[model samples]
Target: MKEKKEKWYKRLEMPDAFVIIFSIVLLAAVLSYLIPAGTFVREEVDGVTRVIPGSYTYVESNPANVLDLFVSIQKGMIDTANIIFLILIVGGIVKIIEYTGAIDAGINVLIQKTKGRYMVLITLVALTFGILASMGLVANAVIAFVPIGIALARNLKLDAIIGVSMIYLGYYAGMVAGIFDPVVLVFAQTIAELPLFSGMTLRVFIFIGMILSVIIFTNRYAKKVKNDPSKSILGNRPFNDDEGITNIEPPKFTVLHGINLLIFVGYLGFFIWGAFTRSWGINELVGVFLMMGFTVGFVSRISPNKFVKIFIEGARGITYGALVVGLARAVVIILENSQILDTIVNATLVPLQAMPTYIGGLMLFVFNLLFNFLVTSGTGQAAIVMPLMVPITDVIGITRQTGVLAFILGDGITNIVAPTSGVLMAVLAVGGVKWTDWLKFVWPILLSWIVIGTLALLYALVTGYGPY
Candidate 1:
């Protein structure tokens, strides 16, 4: 047989997540040498450190050496250890739940009840994800739901993209709205000195716009795939069978399955309560998840030894994603160590400074859109950008609340596309989708989000959204 030549496009393959992130780190290191280092005078404000405007000064160049590049990776891992472990533990818990066959059974029942009306399922699931995220569901915590999303989609004859999108698309949708998002909205608003949740009316409208956009986009693609399997982005590509969700064997919905699912639902409700009332952090969240896993395992009658083995297997399966989060953090670490992060911020903002308030607000959205690739954490990005935005918004004739709106709108929508987002990478990893494949599937909806997000920022700016 003669060998066939590969297509040029096929040959121009994007590297895996690790390679892509590391390359960014390398680029950041190189930029450190080129972009002069700078700093801003920061002081404690309202119990948090914030950069003072007009305090930015050119600092001695502190280029990252080869040693710093390697060390930053270690530091990044340590810094994000809490998040990485939380993901691992959640993976294990999800694994334990899957072992109970409860999720599969529940998915089968859902599929049967829905009569394969995939759009309904997509809307409900995605909306649920979005709503919960709006109510302070941490982004990485979305991984806990990916298995159910993927399994539900697969069982319904939809592709993995539909499943993952149902979860993350809705998540980012709600996240972008920042209705009550503690990490994104709270941090941004507090730093911007806006009344917490004061501008929610506009945010609610933004949420509706975004979630509807997600549903319409997801439903369109799903309808095409359901009508023609060849339309799937994962066409002809086999899912990893080891994930267990890909090749679902529908199980009977037993009484135990019902009990387990109820427990799972209850756990989610409690999680939201804890987040809202108790202000539970990641460690607390992890503790509750562990409790849920064990409770499910006990109810399912899985023996201790088997539970241990399954937990390990689940954690092992998710190791790739957990590490990717830390790897992404390394890029930020490199930028910070090089002292060019502030320089990058200053350079980006200088252009926006000269624009009108409305235009500057839009430009701020664009800036955060690009900057999110460097600082993927919502709270982290707010910490860096919100302080600076407060002063700029003041001078630019926009309310601090308007700045917060722009910051979040720009921060969130691209999560589905940002390779530097550990939570996003982890979600993709869990869903068994490649970055390239996800990018191709997501670009259309992402464009829709961009339009919707742009309009939301303009509305905020025009309305002078604020209590300040």
Candidate 2:
């Protein structure tokens, strides 16, 4: 008997993360040849680069060649090495903690308490991550939570996608809300010359809307998968369920487990404090993670050799996620080198400037969403885009606060779906989720966020959404 052929659309499959990213890098390089290059005048302010508003001028096109593509990859890798290594180290640390059965035992205790009320657990976890993210949780910092999320998924008999959504969505959603995201909020507001975290009443509503959307979406999917295991996006089981928490009986929470959990919690608290107060970067955080790992290893009574072995194993498991960060960064390298990024920004903004007040406000959100695909760094994009947005907002008869909101919401919401977002890719990689699978599961939530963000931007434009 002959089998029927699948439809052409059905036959198509998205490539893995590396291919998708590299293809984009290639496209960016090619566009350099076709598009005119331009740049904005930039000056060093307090040791940081800031683009001058109205400084855009066409420069000679410097298209990236094939050789440049390879060079950019190397450059990208070097540029993001700190983030790359931090992921590996955090992986090792998490593995060490996991080997002690501390995560299992602690999660087991919580599982029992919330046995039938998993949505409550989901809501609490989502809110915790979201709130922390708003308070200034960095993207790479979210990596440390991925493994724990997967473990939670296994315990809940849900798919890895659901587990990742609970944490990843929560964090990114909060970031888009930008209620108090120090990196994006403070930088954009400062650049726009608005009061720091000013207009937060609107942002608080964004924060709540985003977090609640995450909870509701995550719960619905969790229920669907729970009722029918076959409906899982990752298929009947998971991508890598070798240490299946559901299959094995959870170990009892013991004194050693309690100590390990306490140490872990304490480390996170200290790290958050240091991150906000001391302005800890990746290197500083790595040192602290190492210290936490060794302390937990010693307290868990893991022998030195055993600890080394487990740490290596954990790091090895996360190599896929770690390496992809550089690959994603290569896209930015190509765009910056080609000098077309500013040209694209200039071209996009000109049309918006001609738009009506409310339309321009909504378009600002749309532009940021598209622009984020090329420049994913929050502060970096702010340095490049926010300067231009301030003048545009004034011309469009909207508050600068409105422009800042558009910038943050556009940049933050698209992180969920943007191919150029290294953090998003890294999180999915760490979660043992395929890029395609995540896209399929996340599109609806992404749409909901887009709607919420667009409406908010429109409201801001209409209300002159600002204290400034």
Candidate 3:
């Protein structure tokens, strides 16, 4: 026992995303041997496929053999190929921007504009990110901009965590609020047959609460670091407070840099237009970002070969994150191939029918929280769980809108820690923050959010706040 305790694994080493995800895939394969296999019939709901209520059935065991387990990794990669490409493109674009020194020049201008009042800068940055993240289409797109937050933090003389938290938690808080999210909010409400964006007042309040919570939490940390640089967890490393650009003389805020930033803002407008009106998905986003890199590269006057070199370097840097996403998808594939995902869903949700209405609803939220580890995709979560949940809410004297609320709360909030989240892996990669460190920093606030989420769901249960 002593030797085991002393082992590095036992002492606790934070496994990187690849290890964590591959381990999950292995666990899913093992579960296939123990859990009964089942399937759910899916039907077209408003041109979208959805699981049919009351259509679950046990099937003959299809235990995932070794061959199937190995095959799943490749299949999983293929299934999420679009997301993988988008990740690579985002990495490339970020690198291209960096090569041009546009970020440093932009921050120089921002520093002059803000006049070192970091409270105003941090709050404004957090709110801007929160608003953008509230739009589901822009959420993943926001990952490419993580470096800017770090730059802003460095310029403000704060640590990396402070800058990242401003973007990560700020966006995440808005995401969990599910205010205008098409995937987790509208899609969930649609499955539950509630009006689009129903329960607006309560969610609006929750949204505000979330934004404020993130801002307050981030501000506190920023202050701690400001008061004593030694207080930052990241200070333990070969910490450089200069953010790598402090030595650049004269703080070059050239007109060319302004045009480059303007071009970026214009591209953001185009990108937002595409996401909203064109129903742009991963491929469209990849194309837009790739082109944006080229446009900005030329505007910043980087030579073609050098631009390509830096862009490739950036994309190469995030290969691990992209791979993590594909590997994480393997967990779903193994479970689906073995038919245990449906079985697990059935096993978890079927029991809610027997519990008291409020207790059942709360457990439903709990189940979604735990299940998010497996189905990390918000749209995928809504598809699999909503069919199970919407019908239960109807039969259990709970409002369907309440059911949607519980689901978004559970699925959305857990994204930060769930190793399966592609954005989580990607951000962790680019931000250079270990997953363990991120968890340590956020868990207190995360726990508070969980408490808030529970209360919100309980209120929904008590008030039956719904138009349905």
Candidate 4:
């Protein structure tokens, strides 16, 4: 009876990927419509501010109309298209390098060198790559390492999921820390009206700490997956593997490998120099990656025709990922237009304002967690939420930096389970793990991390870690 019940629960809980995604989109649409969102007018007389009656008006132009909705959808499509193009350009170059056997040879050498501590070596590689990814070379890093991760997993008898998770989580965790993160830096600095790299010291410290925690946690979880195949976290019944297997010859190591290696190393060195020196902007870094790809592709001896195909294929694969990004953008657009976002922020802040500082910080932390699902992009969320939060923090006597920290904490932690996160889906697809299965394996750990992160943020607030 217990076994049957467990089976039933597992079966029922399995998320149909399409259905899950569709439901989320539908929910967002419903919320956009049902939530009262419109422009509000506040009149200030003699330094006193009051909400004038009937001042809150639903602007007909601003409501979620057919044209606006269509435009939003179109915008989402365009965003996906741009991402796909970028992926193609980058993926193609990486694929050419792989074809030349450079990456595989490098991994083989590393594995041989690491010997018995391959797991630790792989973890470190993942962490290093994760940090690099946070610096905005994400696509290049992912394309470069995913195949290597798969190879390493096969050799170590570890689930490939571990490698995939390591890369995804590491990058994301670094993103959460937001130290010199282009996305975070631009948005936060703009909204907070602070200088770029203004809070560098503390942001770097948080970034390092978060990266370490991710490494530790992901390594432990992955080790469990490696050691035990029977532990069904999400009740993912093993599927028949007859259909998905593909057979391709592994590349033979040659002189091209050496040339490709030089190219890769040179590119990486330049990137590191650029990052540390702030010698280039994010766009410039992207240009560097493009140059690296072209150089490596040529070195790999990939024929022009084949190279073009590889680029196209890589780009095509990312179409869905880009679409997800666009949808995320649309959600943000709706939040912005609806005016409900302000209301939600004000409502949350009003009650918290009366509380003690620590308690208020805690409230912001909790609010961030809850809101993260709706606003998946950390930078975008900050843009929408921060302005309102900064004012609220001023009113509540909490520092703006505390508000930023809370936003970071909330935004970063939720990506682990957020259905809307493109990277989560990408990782699952790359690892061949089902969505439901991943959530089962990940949720408990992520939830615990959120609590820990929240505590950390509260500590930062109490200690006045930010510019008060």
lDDT of 4 by residue, 323-429 (tens): 44455455556566655665555556557767877777788888988888766666556645666666667777766777777877787788877766655654444
- In model 3, how large is the Cα lDDT of residue 121? 83
Which candidate should be chosen as best, given lDDT against the real structure?
Answer: 2
- lDDT at 60, model 4: 43
lDDT of each: 0.81, 0.83, 0.79, 0.61
Model 2, span 260-337: residue lDDT tens: 988988887787778778887678878888999999988878899999999998888778767778888888888888
The positional error of residue 177 in candidate 2, measured at the CA in angstroms, is: 1.4
Q: Can you tell me which runs of candidate 2 are displaced by over 4 Å?
A: 1-12, 137-140, 239-245
A best-first ranking of the candidates according to their lDDT comes to: 2, 1, 3, 4
Q: Is candidate 3 or candidate 4 better by lDDT?
A: 3
Candidate 1 per-residue C-alpha lDDT over 142-222 given as tens digits, one digit per residue, 9 for 90 to 100: 776788887788788778888888998898888888788766787787777677787888888888988998899889988
Better of 2 and 4 by TM-score: 2
**Per-residue alpha-carbon lDDT of model 3 for 188-253, expressed as tens digits?**
887777788778778777878788888888888888877877787765541232343333443577
Q: What stretches of model 3 exceed 4 Å from their correct place?
A: 1-12, 135-137, 235-250
Worst 10 residues of 1 by lDDT: 237-246
